[model samples]
Each structure stands twice: as C-alpha cells, then as structure tokens.
Target: MSINQIQDEIIDEFSLFSDWMEKYEYIIDLGKHLPLIDEQYKDEEHLIKGCQSRVWLHAGLEGDKVVFTADSDAVITKGIIALLVRVLSNQPAEEVAQSELYFIDKIGLKEHLSPTRSNGLVSMVKQMKLYGLALHAKS
Candidate 1:
C-alpha cells in the first residue's frame, strides 16, 4: 500500500480508541504483524543503536528497491519499529530516499513518546533511509 493509505489506516485505528492506552494497544498489535527474521540475522551487525530496546534491522538491495527486515526486544518499541518499516520497506531506493516520513506527524508519535524513544525512532528511520540511499548510489 502507498504511505498515504498507511497513514489513513493508522489515523482510523487511533481514532477508534479514546485514549493513549488503547492507542498503545493498537501499536503493539502493529508490531505483531512484522514478519519473523531468520535466527542468524539476529546479530550485532543488524542491531539498531540509540533505542532503549534492542532493535535489529537488516536491509538489502532487491533489484532496484531496498527490502528491510527488523525486530525489537520490547513489544511497544517493536511495534514502533514495525510501523516505520511498514511504510518504508520494499520500495525503490529513489522513492525511499526522496520520501518524507509523514506518518510521524499524522500519528502525533513524537508528542507521546519519551524524549529518548523519540530520538531513537528518528535514528532508526534515518538509518533505514540511509541504507536505501547508499544502495541507490551503488546501483
């Protein structure tokens, strides 16, 4: 789905819940949707820095696109990471490089997140996008 469609879906889901607690529950559910990675890929090379939780992200160039796989030890944080990957994964490097992350503002994510979590999320997104940019340059 397009990122706009993903944003619309997330807004709809969050709107159904009356408070942050339920919204958080939805986010956790989103994490559950992430695909499981191979046990071997769960290594330090894939690990994401800056997050309080242990997050592992792996990306590779597939044809002209970049595909990502990620996981996190914390459920809610995993969900947040999954949300980022959902909108960014499996897209062309150019699209990933040019894209603006609109979901963060639409979900009011930064406001609800702790300062550390917010910074970590930014780092995660930047890392994934940078991987795409580097792959684009190589190809």
Candidate 2:
C-alpha cells in the first residue's frame, strides 16, 4: 500500500483507543510484532542519535525501493520505529524522503510523548529520510 494509505490505517487503529494509555499499550503490542533486525546491522553506524534510548535503524535499496530494518533497546522506541517502517519501508526512495507522515500529529503522538522521546522520534524520521536521500542518489 502507499505510505499515505498505511498511515491512514495507523490513524484508524490509534483512533480506536479513547485514551493515551490504551494507545500506548497498542504501540507496545505493535513493537512486539516488529521483525527482528539482523545482528550484523546492529552496529554503531546504524544507531540513531538524539534518542534517549538506543534505536538502531538501517536502510538499503532493493530494486527501486528502500527497505528499513530497525531495533531499539526500549519497547516504546521500538514501537515508534515500527510505525515509521510500516509507512516508509519498501517504498521508492524519493517517495519515502518526501513523505510527511501526518499520522504522527493526527494521532497526537508527539504531544503525548515526553520531550526526549519526541526528539528521538524526530531523529528517527531524519535518519530515515537521510537513508532515502542516499538511496535516491544512488538510483
């Protein structure tokens, strides 16, 4: 599905919960379902900065699309990245770089997160876009 479509789906899921606590629980559940990142990609180079917790993200081009793989030491961070990967992974590099990811604000994620986690979320988005830019350049 397109990134916007995927994001809409996420928003729909988040809307199901009337409270932030329930939403957080759902996010944690999403984290549990995240595909494991390969051990080889867990090195320092893949680690995202600005995050209070350790979040490692790796992206590679497959044909004409970018594929993301990630993991985090914190469950909430893992869930955060899972949402990103769900929207951006397996998408064309240019599209991934350009995606606005409105679902974040739509779902009140940034407002609900602590300041540090919000910064981490920004860093993760920046990193993903950077990877997209690099892959787009190569393509």
Candidate 3:
C-alpha cells in the first residue's frame, strides 16, 4: 500500500478504541508483534540518539525500495516505531524520504505521549528519512 493508505488504515484502527487507555494497550500489543531486528545491527551506529529508551533502526535497499528493521528497549517506543515502519518500509526510497507522516497527529499519538517519547518519535522519523535519502542516492 502507499504511505497515505497505510496511515489511513492506522487511523481507522485507532479510531475503534473509545479511550486513550485502550489505545495505549493497543500500541503495546502492536509492539509485541514487531519484527525483531538483527542482533548485528543493534550497535551504537544504529541506535537512535534522541530517544529516552534505546532504539536501534536499520534501513537497507531492496531493489528500489527501502526496508526498515528496528528494536526498542521500551514497549511503547517499540510499537511507535513499528507503526512507522509499517507505513514507510518496503517503499521506494524517494517516496519514503518525502512522505508526510500525518498519522501521528491524526491518531493523536503525539499529544498522548510523554514529551521525551514525542521527541524520540521525531528522531526516529528523521533517521528513517535520512536512510531513505542515502539509499536513494545509492540506487
């Protein structure tokens, strides 16, 4: 699916919950299902800098698409990244780099998160786009 389509799906999913507590639980559940990142990429180089928790993100090009893999020490952070990856991963590099991730606001994720977590989320998006830019150059 395109990034916007995926974001809309997520928005739809989040809208099903009646309250923020249920949304939090759903986010945690999403974290449980996030694909594990390779142990080799868990080094300092892949670790996201601004996150309060340890988050490692790695991106690679598969043909013209950028594929992302990530892990986070915190469950909620892990789920947040999982949401991002679901929207951005396996997409064309330029598209990933330029995509507008409106789902964060549409789903009210930013308002719901702690300030530090929100910063971490922004950092994660920046890193992903950086990877996209670099990978696009290579391709």
Candidate 4:
C-alpha cells in the first residue's frame, strides 16, 4: 500500500476508540507489536534527543526504498514511533520525505501528548524526513 493508504488505515484504527484512555491503550498495543530494532542499531547514533525517554531509530536504504527500525524505553513513545514507521518505512525516499502525515491530527495524537512528548514527536518526524532526504540524494 502507499504511505497515505497506510496512514488512512491507522486513522481508521484510532478512530474506533472513544476516549483518550482507550486510545492510549490502543497505542501501547501497537507498541507491543512494533518489530524491535537490532541491538547494534540501538546505540548512541540512533538515539533520538529531545525525548523524555530514550527512542532509537535506524534507517537504511534497500534498493530505491528506505526501511526504518526503531525502539523506545517508553511504551507510548514506542507506539508513536511505530505509527511513524508504519507509514514511512519501505517506501520511496521522495514519498517518505514529502509525507503529509495528516493522521497525527486526525487521530488526536498531538493534542493528547504532553508538551515534551510532542516535541519529541516533531523531532522524530524531522529525523525520518532527513533520512529520506539522505537516501533520496544517494538514489
């Protein structure tokens, strides 16, 4: 599926929850399902700064697409990265870089997060796009 299609599926999934508590539970569930990054990739360079908890994201180019692997010390934060990776990974570099990610607002994710976590989300998106850009240039 395309990036937007995957994002739309997520939006549909999050829309089922009626309240923040339920939504958080769903997010934590998603985190639980996130395929973990390798131990080697979980080191210093992949660690995302500005997060209250440790979040490590590693990206690699496969053929013409970019694939991402990530993990986090926090459950909710792990879910947040999982959502991003679901939409962004295994996609063309240009698509990943230019992704609109409208689902963040549609699912009320940004508004529900604390100020610090919100900043971390922004940083995560920035880093993902930067990875996309780097891979795009190489291609």
| Candidate rank order under TM-score | 3, 4, 2, 1
Separate clash counts for every candidate: 0, 0, 0, 0
Task: Give the range where candidate 2 is weakest over 10 consecutive residues by summed lDDT.
Answer: 111-120
**Each prediction's TM-score against the native?**
0.83, 0.90, 0.91, 0.90
Query: Can you list the residue pairs that collide in candidate 3?
Result: none
Compute the lDDT of residue 125 as modeled in candidate 1: 76
What lDDT does model 2 reach? 0.83
Q: Could you tell me the lDDT of residue 132 within candidate 1?
A: 80
Model 3, range 63-112, lDDT digits (tens) per residue? Answer: 99999999888888888888999999999999998999889898988753
As for lDDT, the candidate ahead, 2 or 3, is 3
Q: Which of candidates 1 and 3 is the stronger one according to TM-score?
A: 3
Local accuracy of candidate 4 as per-residue lDDT tens digits, 1-139: 9999999999998888889999999889988886769999988888876546777889999999999998888888888888888899999999999988888888998653445554366677888999999899999
Model 1 residue runs over 4 Å out of place are 111-115
Q: Considering summed lDDT, which 10 consecutive residues are worst modelled in model 1?
A: 111-120
Name the top lDDT candidate. 3
Model 3 alpha-carbon drift over 4 Å, by segment: 112-119
Residue pairs clashing in model 4 are: none
